[model samples]
Target: MINFYSFRDLTRHTLLLSFIFLLFLGEANAGVVVGSLTENFTCDGQIYQTFPTNGDTKLFEAKLDESGLVFTPRLSPNNESIEVQIKALLPGANSVSLTNSLAFNPIDNFLYTVVRANLNDGKGKRLIIFRIDRNNVVELAGIPENNGTIIDEAGANVSSSGLVAGAFSPINNLYYLTGVRKPVYVVDITDMSFKKFSAHNFNIADIAIDPVSLSLYASNKRNSSNQLVQIEFDDINNPTTIVRKGNAAPISSQVNDAVGASYFTPAGTYIGYQNKPGKIFSINLTTGRTTVLANGPNLVFNDGASCPFDFEVDLDNSTLTIVADDAIADGVDINTIQATLLDVNGNGSERKEVSFSATNGAIIGSCTTNFFGKCLVNVTNVKAGISVIGATVSDGTLTDTVSVTFIPGAGDPLKSLITANPTTLVADGSSTSTITVQVKDSNGNNVNNGGDTVNLTASSGTIAAVTDNNDGTYTAIYTSATTVGTATITGTLNSIVITDDASIILKNGAPDAGQSVISANPTTLVADGTSISTITVQVKDVNGK
Candidate 1:
């Protein structure tokens, strides 16, 4: 016999189903979790994307979450059969903004191209520019494939100004555009005009401008070795490499097919780089020393095909997100890894080494081994500006150098002007005074016996005695005659005019008794004493005159 379900029971079941549906909707609408994917590549015609099924099919997605806020990575299409690599995620307008390259333009919608993927700028369109629409979509704006000339027929990478360091100069309100080959051009975006000066043949990789010093720093990668050459430019148009051979450390290994990326720390004290094996290293710009702070696990799968292509530092979070690729035959093989937070003790030394797995995107292993022990050399009691800080890590099997720059304090050295105790006194009347002065350096340290001198001169008064305490202090005594008048005194140092115009007052002589003086023909009674006499003398200031 068949039985029918009760109406109440059916109603209860329906309510339960509705409640479950609402719960699922809430979860879907909820913001991204800590490790949840916020963005991913779907199906874009980019060579940099991996196919998972075929090594040649560059078609993968870039996955991101809210945790990866500052970084915006993208995949570009390449005509070559080989797999393409995404090197960096530069600043963009919004989430959908993707470009072949990244550069800062003075104008709102300037263009740029991604040159060597993870290597150096190779050839045609090695330097390209793009424009972003209001919708945040990137389009090819300028693609100057020409190897020479500042402006081509197509108005590609041509700039109003001549050759410069990078495509952008935020400090000087300028922008540069180059043709990958020769002649770098610079333009003054403030005035919307091109500069007459142009930089000659020079391989510029990354550039940084010092706003305070008005100096430009250009990183040049050598054609033969992975070494980086540093060039300083007074103006972006005319570049000069301060070190011909470049800094002491090499940016990358000598192995073939290796690439590196570098950036200056926000503080500008250190420059950091990311290489294969998902490692991060920094060079002290002042000392020219390099130190490896974090080294991720070596890519052993896919015959070392698993490598880190590009990386960016989120100084706010103190975390580094590396775009890693496990170049297996399928698109699903492409992935990214968040490097373990390095425990640096301000000394540029690591407290421990931690490695995470890119496959699971989790912490895999860690060790307390000090890799820099052999490479670090101790440099003690060194002065600022190119002082070598050496460290020996791993028992000195390898060596490394660190450059340290020390900045001096600001303000004048002397705190107060020299002052005298009794600035005004009677001359030749036996008056004692103290001339005191305080000498110090910018650091507030007393500059004892720094060859300081003080000369006392009398404009009207006489100096009976003068003595130097030798501790930035002095004393002087004066004697005045019985003449009723005022005297002026002054002080000097090495003709620098330390102090001037001090005054002293002189009074009349004392009275005596039983003394008589003869006067002129009228026989006037002139007495030195006996007759009570009261005198009122007005004090006069000599220097006031």
Candidate 2:
């Protein structure tokens, strides 16, 4: 069935279908949809072709009698492969050549292309930039047209060549262009002005950026083979210089000649396209390792761009893990704690900040994770007790906790004893005696755990105050009362649950004979010896008791 539809309808239909497919494919299966310029109108002498077997499930295609632009979607190379090509069209245009550069502006939802155009006055060809919308609509892009003053490149002159590569950086909303061994030309889309800066050192072929980190990646043959390098800007907003960061390992030979590169943000994957064999591969941002995914139409003037896929944090599926020793010795022990964060797929998320806390010790409050999604902090000045260490993300979305027990170097409090220096006190109510309590461990050695709570109590006398000697002993003043009795002094070690007691005697003071008074029951005793009357007498001391 052949149903002819307008280019707009076809574009909308294709976009809807692709969106639906992507919805079904979760983050793990998500891929980068790329549109680049092919070397020739016809790829490898085939007008239309498809890879049924040993092909990436995501399609790659080229067309005949059309512009050099071709669209390819790179899928999980290790899992599935497919290749296909279909007819392409443009409004009121049949054939065109995009030999210079292609970039997609995510903010404006327009594809920008720099192409050579000729004037009707026979003034030689001049480079003109054009923008295309999703509905296959194209228009001259650079606004407030410059009279060759803003753009000073030799190629800007209608007589010479111009840009060899281009990339659109969403970080600063600027378009970048460069030529062979030439300084980069910064194009401000807002003002349509070009500023030149010699920041890049390599002969850049194509550049891609990670919007999250603003890391600019370039594919260049600076060291004899095409390799991936990261370009760091002094300031993305107002950049004056740039430095190149090389990969830790060499790029695979399979992607040695890769000319086009793009980053798939959903999976944190970098993709590269090679024209020599029309193959696609993935590049490791740190190691520069490449894994070929599929083969398709050969493209020479190739460059790709895809929307930075936003990955939602799975709060329920993501996990936070903490690692530390369960038990720490009393002395000379390392107290380092570590935390790791992983997404739903169990892959580490880099550059995340996490906070740490402890219950009974001092610890580093926060730490930022590295490339491995891991961070470390130290716990110091811990006490002799169990402490819980907790780690949580900045947003408090994920959390993990662990417990550690610190052994006391001095020893644990076991038993307690109470004693009085002067075990006896006068009953005058003004006499006081010294009371002391000592604590010992299981080995009968005086020990201070720095957290011992010793309480003192007296059955008769009053304890004026108690003082912790800070060693293993405590002291208190026992005030005596007028009544003669024995004060049972009790000492309790609250932390270790041990108790002991000692007795203090309150004895009567010396009787004063001068103050003593005597009384007789019968004042007048019968004087007669024969009348022996009963006589009774009472005596009083100084206290009148």
Candidate 3:
């Protein structure tokens, strides 16, 4: 017997059959998937690490060309190329809007989305959760317990209807949904059974969970800035008390609208999208700073979802090295201590903050890696010992270390010895002697680097400028004084408690003809040779010798 159905039923059956056919043609692909209100979703094809570039716009534009979907006001670009493509035509054909949110469950290998029915009777306002199959085709997942057919444990309707954000935790195998100041709803996708989670004070706009830690976080607008807050629970799997933990830092102005957020575990960053400026950005879980990744197609009532395998940081392949510009030495300043991070797909990563520490030296506490994934710090005041220099990324995930042995350049002033070539010298002003000053370290090693200074002074002679021989010895010329006396030669090294002295005796030299005078008492009597006058002569030097 042939049965005739109404027009509404015929249309519903046609769409259902069409959707099934689309699912049959499903092809496998992988990426971070984003959904919009128009039931259009696209998998982000850009590399996760290269998030700061706007090159992904071309991928979206290409998708639009294939789908032949009209670009509406919300999807239009503002000085940017088309950013996303409509993967399915279910929104207009099936009379539904994906306004609520979207989430991906890696365990089931399905992408789930929440959609609102666009019926004029307002009878189908209840939110419906649908799963996007591998071929980008939409299928009904389940109806949430929101005063509808679905019921809670008490067989009562959960009068809650609005859910703006959603996230799936592979650890617990539950999908979490919530709205601003609403109690979280946890659903077991295996059976579609759900429960209302503990209430929280945070007005969350979107939510993401760290896959490694199983810690849930929310993007919130607080005090004029978009910030990230930790939504803590007594037990995430079976929670009784939920509390808000963080308001520490604000995500920068780049993230204006927190439409959706997802955690890319490979790089340990929370990826989010803004609807206003159509900006894709990543938030550092450690610092609340936000970095604009790319400008893509704007989405209204949008949501983002990503699998853990979307991007990868092959730590085994990645490498880090500590490079020193020169040989390290004690008390020497090493201005070129660099830590280079490399090997993410065989290339340097973007600028990231790195921390430095040393075992037996002082170093700059932290530095940010440059475009080449290299960071520099200065090491100073190193002791004469083996030192280990450690460099770590801000998250403490990637680390590298190098050991350096510092040689003692010049130590404390230990000993200074002064010697005179001739300990005794004539009092003639022209006579000179050598004064040598030898400097040594605590271990009696010659301070060959000239790190120590030497000075010479004579008590009774004129000393010339000291000369550094660079072999731990210094020399100066000392001239003997005309006045016969002892000359004390003093030498100091570094002027820090190291001093030596030597004395030189200046004896009388042969009388200098230029400085001597001779007087003859019988000068007048010499003329009278016959007078037999007694003759006497007096000879003296300038000093009356």
Best by lDDT: 3
Model 3 gets an lDDT of 0.55
Candidates arranged by lDDT, highest first = 3, 2, 1
Candidate 3 per-residue lDDT over residues 285-353, each given as its tens digit: 776567775676565445556554432323444344546543435455463466665534343443566
* Candidate 2 residue-wise lDDT at 484: 90
Off-target runs (Cα >4 Å) in candidate 3 are 1-94, 104-112, 117-161, 181-183, 197-203, 210-215, 222-234, 238-302, 305-453, 456-466, 469-490, 493-545
CA lDDT, every prediction?
0.33, 0.52, 0.55
> Per-residue alpha-carbon lDDT of model 1 for 239-329, expressed as tens digits?
3332132343455452112222233332232332232344444455555555555543222111100011112221222332333422221
Q: Candidate 2's residue-wise lDDT over 1-545, tens digit each? A: 11112223344335434422332333222222222221112111111112222322122333211123345433322223211111122222222224234555555655555544333223333344555443333334432123212234333452135464666676555776664455666665654555676535565566666665565666666554766666666665565667545442356776656465344343345655665667666665645557665665665545555544343333454444435553344334446677666544444444567777778754445776543456777665335556677766645655456676654344333445678978998877778888877766543445554456766778886887778788777788988878898888876676554456788888877766765566555556677776544454334346764
lDDT for residue 363 in candidate 2, whole number 0-100: 47
Model 2 CA deviation exceeding 4 Å by range: 1-6, 11-83, 86-166, 171-201, 210-221, 224-318, 329-332, 342-349, 397-400, 409-545
Best by TM-score: 3
TM-score winner between candidates 1 and 3? 3
lDDT of residue 512 for candidate 3: 56
TM-score of 1: 0.30
